[model samples]
Target: MMALVGPVGPVGIDQLGVYVPEYVLPLDQLAAARGVPVEKLHIGIGAQQMAVAPPWEDAVTLGANAAARAIAQGHISPDEIGLLLVATETGVDHAKPASIFLHELLGVTANCRTLELKHACYSGTAGVMIAADWIRSGAARGRKALVVATDIARYDLHSSAEFTQGAGAVAVVVSEQPRLLALDPISGVFASNVYDFWRPLDRREALVDGKFSVDCYLNALDGAVADYRNGHSTPSGALSEEFAALLYHTPFPKMAYKAHLRLIEGEWRAAGRNPADLGPAAEQSYRTLVEPTLGAARVVGNTYTASLYLCLAWLAEQQGRALEGRSLGLFSYGSGCCAEFFSGQCVAGSAKVAAGIGVADLLAARRTLTVDEYEAFGRDGAGADLPVESRANFCRFAGVREDKRLYERTGSLAQ
Candidate 1:
């Protein structure tokens, strides 16, 4: 659409697609009933809203929606799509790659390379990294790569982290010499110790220490930032004071706030700079984002792999073109204690790319579920059938006779 201001690179997110189901669990309501101030959950996890997925929305359905929209908008033909990737711990099948289902729903070419990746929340970024390399290699014969990061964040009912649960997806299309901002060749990544979150196949909820997870986020955030700063040369004119917008891996919105403020504090103290010297714009930008982050994310909770990208979607909506053409800082952290620090330029098309979602309409269209409905939805998986509310047609349950997977086609490939 002539919106991309610069030459594209192999690694940049050319088009981004986001999908959050209509149903949401508002945090203030939860807090009021829990007999505490809204700030309790609000301040505790930095989440104000969390989106819950009923049976109708699964990783397959949500990821398909996001990926389909991105590809269609980018004018990519299904025949030219060589890689179909679905990265999530909440994958549809333990044995089968979720990409197969995506292929069926999106009508990707039969010759595609389909694979499912798992590395906690980092799986999505991992998919992007590898797909970039694949595109750069050009061995796929003019084919582009499509990666969908989808997940549902669930903790056992009544767990402290339970309120942070969310479901969503972010789709990215990577191609060679494309339309979008170019990615920098250099990036920073680090793997710290692991202890925060993990769940086995049999378990439905996540297990973790909230303090430990928060501690990991702060340490990883600082660690990655320090690594990037130490190795890279800064840009001229306010390298110390200037940055476009800082987006962090939002396990929850409040957690990101705590980490962001801590980063600002450390940055100011290290430079002997007055925090207020930067003026209200910088502070307000960060505040406007992180303050309502918890509230905004409380309803959607944590979408795991899609968490950070989902934050980018929110930032695009609120920040507008002010962030365009500027350097955007990002921190991505995963549960296994993996973290990466990178920067992306906000090209002219940033807002336009983010403008495709019908978030308000989707929110209005969802069917809200009570605690009982949520429990039923959460518990309906395994060698069994999907719950009554499921609307996943492409992979509908057909009562397992043995251990083999059987899929029922719902519709044509929409990719």
Candidate 2:
């Protein structure tokens, strides 16, 4: 419950960029292939489609494309970026940091600091917080920080977690007087030693206790929101009354809905009302404050580290001008497990910045893959070391040679 002490001035996300692979798998196809009811996937988990990365497209490539898109769309010069923070659960190498690869691919200057952060799905928020703090501390030296949250969520092909798998990246530029979302330096955090979800060094797919993870997520949400209410003082209203929208780290879209209900129930109890009678009320509140954030996530599945930011992007895109000047509450949860609740507000030019990133265009561009074709492609990065022709993507994972991961600039934003 310790406060994140700082100047707490106007420093936050200046621009946002996103990248999803061109390939997509509709969850109905997967449900049918698995002999499961499609409604269970569509209604139970709230997933429709998921982005599928080819073997050659790993975290490094996905992150690089996203960062490049940010630089290009935001009209930011790579030399002006002083720090590069990449957050991912899927790491390509044991020794090397993915940020270094992104630095080279995005043409960042030699003077930049590069590193990677991992804490399941929450590392992306960690990077953003660190970047904002760096700017606040004057450590950035008038240069912006680029925080890239990139991941390929993988699970056993025929397992229960399979429909939740997706791949994507979200890149944000943090700096002074940001044009997109202006972040508050204060944050509420919670952590515990729990193994609700984890992946070992030897395995490509993650292990998750579905029911336990849901419980953990709800508990962490409670802890984080309580801490947030304690430390926050500037916004002079109740949590539900102060914020225009709420976003959560979405492993799947339904998980977010559950978190909202948990928050609403807590609010109901605190107001001396019956929590059991708040179901319809909670659903209505969720529709107004949280549902807009899930459009991209419903289609993309679990983006792991990029999940929360993906929601922000979706919200900005869906609400457009309506979001300007409105404040938002965001909760980030990662299992093994840590959680944080933070605040941000949409700035004057938020709509333009969001539109420039073109989130809708990215989702509309994906090519649907057949279930058999997806299975043939596999979850492991099998043909990653082989050479292939460059496509219209901004960059690609070319091949690995002599124990080095190689990448190439295939095209530009215009293509």
Candidate 3:
């Protein structure tokens, strides 16, 4: 990993795009089917629905769909993208990087550099930071980099993590003079050899120690935030007071809320104030600073590597013009476990660009699935019976043949 130092100029996300599967399994429906209380899913984990990808949609397809939207939204030509970095844990092939498929699907030039990054959920943040560094180093030579975080979160049926299953992708075009958020060059980072969560190659679903993962997450946040504050010596007020809002790597919506609470407790402890005395003020702060970021995640569930960026998309879509010139604190965490705390400022005209993205509209348009239908999707021999809708210009996985995985776009890229 490259050391994060101050950049020469502002370099960050120029445009953002997101793609969620059209199908969703409502948590209430899943809860009823499993004989679990609905509140445990709705209020406990703070998830309402989980997006479900059809068999034809893999990480590559989902990522391509998002990258296409971003390219269109940014008015970027394929030749202008000098680098393409894809972040995902749910990769389709063991040897080929997912970026190669995305490059073909998105019609990028052969000159572009492509790579795949994996660090559980933290890979997206790593991609963004690396892209920014590449621009600062003059490696892109005035060309932009496209970073896409895409994943399908799957778990064994009837397992503890079943309700968190979801599929989605988030893409951002990174360049100088960005129209969206401008990232601060310095980032606080931490890593450890803890195995709180992991997926072995033989298994299709991930194994997690839920309670241990939560503890690891909180510890990583503490370490990252401390390193961040060390670099930023603010005399005005508490470090938390410097940001308009805070966003965290959300495996689920409630996890973000917990991350915010941890920040509050850390600040209070540093000031020799009893964290128990935080009272209603901490709750109010969370409502003001964090609630908006969770709206999309509550509906989409855990997107793994896409999870953190998904929060940023939701915030930009919801807050719009209100975010102009304000600073935002962001934290990213990946289990096994790596973490980072960083800051970015909402650029001017961000609202206008954000308004054009249509993230909220995409969420509103999803179709709900019956519990039986959701279960059947995981069964073998179900793929042939599934109908593949031809979404214009969207890529779909056309089953493997002769050890070669096939892909096709529904509509022409030239169109």
RMSD of each: 5.0, 3.5, 3.1
**Model 3 weakest lDDT span, ten residues long:** 381-390
Q: Give each model a TM-score.
A: 0.84, 0.95, 0.96
Ranking by lDDT: 3, 2, 1
Residues 1-415 of candidate 1 have per-residue lDDT tens digits of 5343343344566676667765677777666655667787767665676687766567777787777667666667778789878988887677888778878767787899999988888788778777777766556566788889999887876666777788988887876654444455556677876888888777777798778888877887777677776667641123224456677777776667677776776676576787667556455767654543233355577889988777766666556567677766667788778887777676776666556544444545666666565666667644445565643333343445576544554543342
Q: In model 1, where do residues sit more than 4 Å from their true spots?
A: 1-11, 32-37, 177-181, 235-240, 273-285, 288-298, 317-320, 379-401, 406-415
What is the lDDT, from 0 to 100, of the residue 407 in candidate 3? Answer: 81
- For candidate 3, what's the RMSD? 3.1
Q: What is the alpha-carbon lDDT for the whole of candidate 3?
A: 0.88
Model 2 lDDT tens row, 234-341: 322357767899999999999989999888878878877889898578889999899989999999888899999999988887786998999999999999899999
Off by over 4 Å in 2: 1-9, 233-237, 384-391, 413-415
